[model samples]
Target: MEDLFYFKLFLAFTVGSTMVTLATVAAERLGSRIGGLIGGIPSAVAISLFFIGYTETPQLASEATSTIPLTMGLNGLFLVIYVGLARWGAWIAMAGALFFWVALAFLVILLNFNNFLFSLLFFILSLAGSYLILEKGYHLPSTEKILMPYTPLQILSRAFFSGSIISGAVYLSRVGGPIWGGIMAPFPTIYISTLIIMAKSKGVEFSRRITKPLLVSGMVNVVVYSTAVRYFYVLFGLALGTVLALGISAASTYGIYWFLKKRMS
Candidate 1:
């Protein structure tokens, strides 16, 4: 049992840190749109759900995914808040985003929002609303590649934040049943880490430029991943199911990236 617990933490930390480091680096080299898309991929959630199924049951993991879309909707709002408040300062932006995320995420738990379609509707609304506000209202543009040298500290900081958040989510999911697990699985740890790293290194405008793409990519990624997990985990079992779901997510992410790339061009 102790070994399993340690293993879970280790898995979470390794995946979290690796994903953030790669995404941040990609964002710096390729541009925010690409970086955001990469960052938004189904990294931590995949790991979280896999362990959920492994530690508990496949049905439980599938049920836990029901709230993912709704939680992802809240995450969209999370980016909106962060982008809106970013010009003020990192602390304000971080605090405001987190405050809203926690408040509304618990609202999801309190209301017992378990219906999949309704959660889908909530996610659709968030998808549309966040895009319009960020792209139309904010008039945020796609950022060109901003070249910067990588330092060990930057990588470590991003990894630390992402790893810690994901580890907490994984641990919490064990206590909360499927709904709690589902919501907790898709927590915006990557987004939080990305924003902090980018806002500090690249500044507010850069952060703002990335938010729309991040929203588009992140939400879509979660929706597809959760949907896949809901169905796939039971049919295929953990190892195979995780791979299949990840494949689907990768395909969908490519589709989103291609569309966004065309739009940006």
Candidate 2:
């Protein structure tokens, strides 16, 4: 039943993107700048974080993850630091997914998770993501997007936001693992993008939409960190938690992106 719910959530997002794409196409035909911008690429930061949040949310929220809360905290923190320094937004968003996948593969090699179930869950998720990228090309406006290089504000904003989200996700996932840790990673980013678009249409430029999510999201992670440290003695510890966490996040991320890239091409 729970797995079914997840599938439904994925389906909803898939349908939502389709509707948005259709609207974008209509807007393109109407020849309005706002419509055209609607069809444009979301900031790379948005896309990356969206993926992270989607993957991690269930882990952090579920009863299964509760059994290893300490593992989740340590695992999340270890992974966050690794991704925080990455040069690109895509890398950070994809890290947990990539790590999830790699870790899963090795787990199978060592016979940890049930092989059949792992393969089934992975294939379904991968297909959904691939279908999304294939169905809609971001079609960024050359004039506006190309100006990213010259926009001091945009460059700085992207760097700071991307780094903060990845670092926070990493740490929180330590307390939450894939369920909580993975899901928490992307909320602020998603919230920011949704608002930026709505505000752009209305011509509002308040930084609050972006900054507030950052603060709230970071606070949530800080809570997880404090909770983890308090119960640190209880986590019993996984032998190679960090490596495994990285492997887990990295593999899933790579598989989905590769599938999307190939399908779109």
Candidate 3:
């Protein structure tokens, strides 16, 4: 049990760090909107569910998805809070957003929101609400490519920050049942890292610009992956299910990027 626990934590750290780094680099090279699109692709939840299914039971992994949609909905709220407070400062925005995420996630777990249909509905509402708030309300414009150069130390530090947070989340998630696991699996640690890095490197405005695109990405990518895996893992087994889910996610990501690019142009 102890060995497995450590392994899971390590895996979480690796996935969290790699995903954030890729998103950050993508933003720096491509642009914030593009970065947001990349960021929304499945990261922690994919690995989390895969490992949960591998180590535990496929059924447990499937059960763990019971609250994933609701948790993802909360993640959308997380972005909203960050962007809303961005003008104040990056630290303030990240801190405030994290507070809401932690508080609301706990509330979700306490309430035991395990119904798939309602959770899915909540997720949809969140996506729509977030779109309105960021795009229509704030009208945050997309940022140009940020020309910031990264040092090894900077990359290492950002990875450490994301890794530690996600490692903790992964470790604690297993303590409770599948519902708790589901909720914690999609914790906004990736978003927290990506937001802070982008804000600090480029500026708060750049980070804010990406929020809308990120929301769109979240709406399509995370939802598709989670929903697909909810059934795929059970029907096809862990390895095949993960591959199929990822294939679907990748295709949707391409479609989303194309749509967003057209809209932006």
Ranking by TM-score: 1, 3, 2
- Candidate 2 is scored at a TM of 0.27
TM-score of each: 0.87, 0.27, 0.85
- TM-score, cand. 3 vs. native: 0.85
Over 4 Å off in model 3, which ranges? Answer: 1-5, 8-40, 144-150, 165-170
* Most accurate candidate by TM-score: 1
Q: Which candidate number maximizes lDDT?
A: 1
For residues 1-265, write the lDDT of model 3, one tens digit per residue: 8898788768778877887677657756776556645655776677777767765777788888888888888889989999889889999988998899889888887887789999999999998898888878888886433355666677777767756655654555567778877877777665665576677787888888877766776655877898889899899998999999998888888788777776676
Q: For residue 72, what is the lDDT in candidate 1?
A: 92
lDDT tens digits, residue span 111-191, model 2: 423222343344344433332322233221111211111134433443455445544544444453443333333333433
Q: Sort the predicted structures by lDDT, highest score first.
A: 1, 3, 2
In model 1, the Cα lDDT at residue 225 comes to 90
User: What lDDT does model 1 reach?
Assistant: 0.79
Q: Which model is ahead, 2 or 3, in terms of TM-score?
A: 3
Per-residue error (Å), model 2, residue 154: 2.2
- Positional deviation of residue 176's Cα in model 3 after best superposition, in angstroms: 0.8
Candidate 2 Cα errors over 4 Å, as ranges: 1-152, 162-183, 188-239
Instruction: Look at candidate 1 and give me any clashing residue pairs.
Output: none
